[model samples]
Target: MSQLMSIDTFLDSEEVLVDVRTPSEFLKAHIPKALNIPLLTDQERAEVGTLYRHKGKEKAVLKGLDLVGPKMSDIVRSFLEVAPKRTVRLYCWRGGQRSQSVAWLLEQAGFKAKILKDGYKSFRRWVLNHFEREYQFRVLGGYTGVGKSDLLQILENKGAQVLDLEKEAHHRGSAFGGIGLPKQPSTQHYENKLAMRLRAFDMRLPIWLEDESRLVGKCAVPEFLFQQISRAQLFVVCRTIEERIVRLCQLYGVEQKQSLIDACMRIKKRLGLEHTKKAISLIEAGLLDEATLIILKYYDKKYQYSIDKRVVSLYLNGSEMSDVQLAERLLNR
Candidate 1:
């Protein structure tokens, strides 16, 4: 018979792991590196759940078995193809029924299938706990056009440990975030990339991270990292709107002018069609200052909202210091 182990134990072992949760559940979140092989088709899983609630567990279980029985051979074959040659760990939502059933079937087929005791819920708890541990962080906070990315490049040159969350998420973290960026990773891939980055950092030193939201582009930030950002200390950079507008224009350049115009136009309903139209005219007329002023009110308010809601510690921008000096104070503070 195959053994059942806690999620921690399974993770500790040098073996492949499979997550048997439905694709939707797996997409929202899952153990890093676990392959998904759902026991039920999405529709069938919904139907069984509906039956279980309206009818009875006995009826649902019977129907579930009937649905899965005919596909058992194919499921086993697919599992064999993905499962490690030596040993494999399997888990479902709670480790009681679905995972155990799958493990027993795999064991009967002469494979070492270890079920994750307490399953994915337990693993999620572990991820949450890890984030609660006290770790130093070097925050990168700036206004919409302060050239934080460029500063990050300088910081990297100076050998500071940094995690470019925007780069990793393939998002710029704004209404125009998707412009000039690759397609965003799925939420699962985002979490996996985050975990990989965190693992590479030295826990003793501060890890540099940009100010970001719970969602970057199409992907939601992992629950753990979201919590960290909420509690982590912050450093703010300031620059004149003119400096920012020039930098934005240079960074985005002519290639993205039409896309920028479209992004501004889409905001018409929110900013009022009159105001949005004026902003568009400013862009078209090369009156970037006018366009920037209008956008600043909208974007600045949004930034303030996040800071207030997330309970971030604010460091006001210094007027006297140079950008490099401002960055140093923020990082060292």
Candidate 2:
């Protein structure tokens, strides 16, 4: 007999997690570490869905059985490889027929299979609702090249609760952020990953986050969490333009010059045509520091505009303080 369990119970258990949704569905968003053992292919699921809408549930059931019959042995073999313990936990989009069917099949094959009570949909609800919970957020606000991300990493190593949103999004929250990063996860998946991390955090401790606009590349910060960040304590870091230019050159200088130019062109409208051309010319001349200074004009102005709208809790001059010293101040504050 298959048992249905709450999402919390499923998360706490160490059983092999199986997602029986189609590959496309799994790709968009899924529980972390859940293996894809799709009961139907993308096309097959679509075909069945269309039939169910046009025909009745009886005809749809018959069609589904016909399609799945030949694949039973293969499914069993695949499950056996991943589930050496012969114990499994699985879910579909909803705790519907597809998951129930798979659970029944596994049971008949002499395996213990438990189903997630409301399936992936329930997990998603769990993910979204997590952002609404209260958190003590410490937002690190600074202009480009101020080393905010670096400091956040140090804080994490010092045992502070930190949410590295850029790491999760594979973006640094800048026009050039995506130049050398891995492909960004879909926004849905980004939320899923963030929620998973948040679930493991101790809520009593302050969560350090790099200040960002709502969107990081293609991923939008969950709205409720973003609101909390906005109202939470803000710490701004300031550094000289020359200092920032040197840091920017060091970070981006190794990338292909063409890639750098393409990044500049992306913000051409905001950067202005004349400034954009000068930045491109500097890049071609291998004067990365000069190019960065030009780009910083736009970014610095934009950052200051955002900072002006918020009440800053503290400001640290990066020119005077080492990153280690600054981190200590933040940690001890």
lDDT of each: 0.76, 0.93
lDDT of 1 by residue, 4-91 (tens): 8875677777677788888887877677778888888778889999999999999999999999899888878888798648368888
Per-residue lDDT of model 2, residues 116-156, tens digit only: 99899999999999999999999999999999998998899
> Each candidate's TM vs. the true structure?
0.70, 0.96
| Shift of residue 84 alpha carbon in model 1, Å | 4.9
Give candidate 2 misplaced runs (Cα > 4 Å).
Answer: none
Error of 2 at 49 (Å): 1.0
Question: Clashes in model 2: which pairs?
Answer: none
